[model samples]
Target: MAEFLQRVQSVVWNRKLIRTAKGHYLGLGPEKTEVGDGTDGKPVYTLVGEAYVHGKMDGEAIDFQVENQILVEKFELE
Candidate 1:
């Protein structure tokens, strides 16, 4: 999985949000994000950046991750 990880990482780093539809461990989402207090709850949206992946695995598995993503600033129903 090392090669798989490397390929994935490269794609993530360039973006502001990393999205993994099926294999999305450290994938894309708003819940796992860490918004700097200075950001002031703007609900950051990105096309690539660092992300969080939590399903049923430990942290040591993928110690470091880097990927890109498609982000949405907000979801509204009007």
Candidate 2:
């Protein structure tokens, strides 16, 4: 699971967001990803970063967090 999360985080960090509204956009982090359990007994992965609002378009910069995970009936390793 740790290895899987690392791979996923690497892919996400290499990507960037381009669309914008009023100069406000989300910027992903200096932080990495981790794994946990979800509400339905499934694996839940989380990624956290900074949220930026530019030029008085909104409030100050703040923490931005998101998750990516999968549910499985059985855990397997290749």
Q: Distance from true position, residue 2, model 2, in Å? A: 0.5
The most accurate candidate by lDDT is: 1
Clashes of each: 14, 0
RMSD of 2: 15.4
Window of ten residues with lowest summed lDDT in model 2: 59-68
The lDDT of each candidate is 0.47, 0.40
Candidate 1, residue 61: the lDDT equals 40
Clash count in backbone of candidate 2:
0
- Deviation in Å, model 2, residue 1 alpha carbon: 1.4
lDDT of 1 by residue, 2-76 (tens): 999999887655444433445455444343444342245555544333345455246444343322343434465
Candidate 2 per-residue C-alpha lDDT over 1-78 given as tens digits, one digit per residue, 9 for 90 to 100 = 999999987756644443243335443323332222123454553435443223323423212211223333455444
Q: Ten consecutive residues with minimal summed lDDT in candidate 1?
A: 61-70
**Each prediction's TM-score versus the true structure:** 0.23, 0.20
Off by over 4 Å in 2: 18-78
Model 1 Cα shift for residue 52 (angstroms): 19
